[model samples]
Target: MTTHPAPAATEIAESTSDASLARTRRRSAEIEEQIAADPGRFRVLTGDRPTGNLHLGHYFGSLLNRVRLQRAGVETFVLIADYQVITDRDGVGPIRDRVLSLLADYLAVGIDPDAATIFTHSAVPALNQLMLPFLSLVTDAELRRNPTVKSELDATGERPMSGLMLTYPVHQSADILFCKANLVPVGKDQLPHLEQARVVARRFDERYGRPEGTDAPVFPQPEALLSDAASVLGTDGQKMSKSRGNTIELGMDADTTARVLKRAVTDADRHITYDPAARPEVSNLVLLTALASGRDPEAVAAEIGDGGGAALKRAATEAVNEMLAPIRARRAELAADPGYLLRVLRDGNARANAIAEATLGEVREAMHMAY
Candidate 1:
């Protein structure tokens, strides 16, 4: 006992931990520099509320790109915004089933289990927590001025919308900022929400957090990834949507998809053409046909031009049916064990929550708002 003093365990552990953190910091900075240079490796937080199953509109608009991105090395997170359903409605009656249906749809579309993490909104409380402090960053008038909220209110004829719906953008900011998400895959209408997230992240960082030089950007202002593809239309040639019950669900079987497409409106002129403005109905059909055939719409139009609207419709129907055949089979297989879908949700929730918790902690620490 009189010979020598022993080394402290705490000192050894701290030394090793500091070394590991330095290595991790250097690696992360390198990856960030690479993304800054290449651009497409941008991390994105994108999702659809699990109010219903995904359909052709979702496929053509965003999900299609997401599938391509996953294959192309983009880090993507697919969220089932189940919590937002209650923002408009009163309960969660159909949401449980809808969530499962959405899961089946995602799996069918080749959203690899390894590539994208899919989860429900409510499952990530850390994300929701961002809502509290985020609320302080914006004015009530700013939320009221959001054009998208106004459009939804107009479309649904819901006067005096819920506070949750009014501030849905804040929640969306939470969805992005919680993951520290920087690149958002968005349609034109969604530009405002991304704008709001940028504002809050910038404002909060300026007010209570640190700035990077001349000005600080706490959050990387997410850039909009735009799409010029024709939107998927429903049977009646209106926008394909779940609320209208006009959507051809991706999870539906081949027979069901074929049946849905068979009933969709086609051009009355019969000759195939690419005039979307003149014949949205037929043009939508032609567009779907082109995507399914892996040919340009101009090419599809040329091939089917001799045929009248009925023939064009029939050809469009057949092409869609052919493309959906395997997807339908895969969906049925997934549907057999519905629990597998729930498991995906659960696993995604765990991962998203962990990341979100870390983000929320940093946000709280920055603002000195931690309780």
Candidate 2:
């Protein structure tokens, strides 16, 4: 017979808890370092509402990075956020179609559905159930302060916001935590929501949820994957947005892309330089030129200085056209193959459902509602 010394139950419990905390800290540090420098971390979640097609801003800002993450071995979860669109408190359609359209773009741009899972917000019942307990963890005051909600409301001039609009971030928290996402790729502006997710996770553990043992945090506090690229501007030099009628869709035709670039705002001084503060318009053009052409922005600026802002705009336009030509072609090819896109979304949704089912079961059991 094998003999072993019996450690006290208290001693055993403390050892396990301490080890778990240490593991969380170590994993957090490692993942944060990677997000700060590298982008390959499993459990990264990012997505958009089906209000519109993606644009150039999304590509440089994150779409490409998402594709990179999926290929690099991280299991990516892309939320279609179909329900988020109805938050406008106005227009909506049969989400089933729009979701498929969005999936087309996702796949066309190399978002391998086989690699990344795409899910709809409305489809996951258990995930949505989280909003109930989740709401109890936070207050109305915090929700009112959500900058995204405030901005959307201000822009739309739609006051008396729908309950959906107000509670969207809480819903967002449920989305991330439901999957136990550890890393969320986001730009600077979206940090607040991630912070809220962490707070909700911490609150859940503190209130009723457990980490590994008695009374510990349930969700891992995710870190922001800060983006280096500035937000792409529309032709008017403001943020590129569909509402502003200035966005260039990722799948737009070459002729259309060129036309939009032609009208783009350039520096008034005529000559191009890298001084963004003194010459933001022309600098913006130079920046776009550099990104599109895969060359040094300053070098492109120097070459164009020989002519003027018009010259810089022309060069930028050409570079943008070239870069977009292939993407547009790929989008066209994918559009023709609608069946493939459908499969991608279907497969993604299944995977997301699986993840949600597991977490949702655990959550219900913890709260004594499993029955």
TM-scores of the models, in the order given: 0.84, 0.85
Tens digits of per-residue lDDT for model 2, 236-344: 7888787898878887777787788778877557666887777777777788888888898789888887588668767877888788777777788887887877777
Q: How accurate is candidate 2 locally (lDDT)?
A: 0.75
RMSD of candidates 1 onward, in order: 13.1, 9.0
lDDT of 1 by residue, 188-222 (tens): 56766776787777667766774223244456666
Candidate 2 regions with alpha-carbon error over 4 angstroms: 1-41, 93-97, 152-158, 211-217
Q: Highest TM-score among the candidates is held by which one? A: 2
In model 2, how large is the Cα lDDT of residue 67? 84
Model 1, 290: alpha-carbon shift in Å? 0.9
Clashing pairs in 2: 270-309
TM-score computed on alpha carbons, candidate 2: 0.85
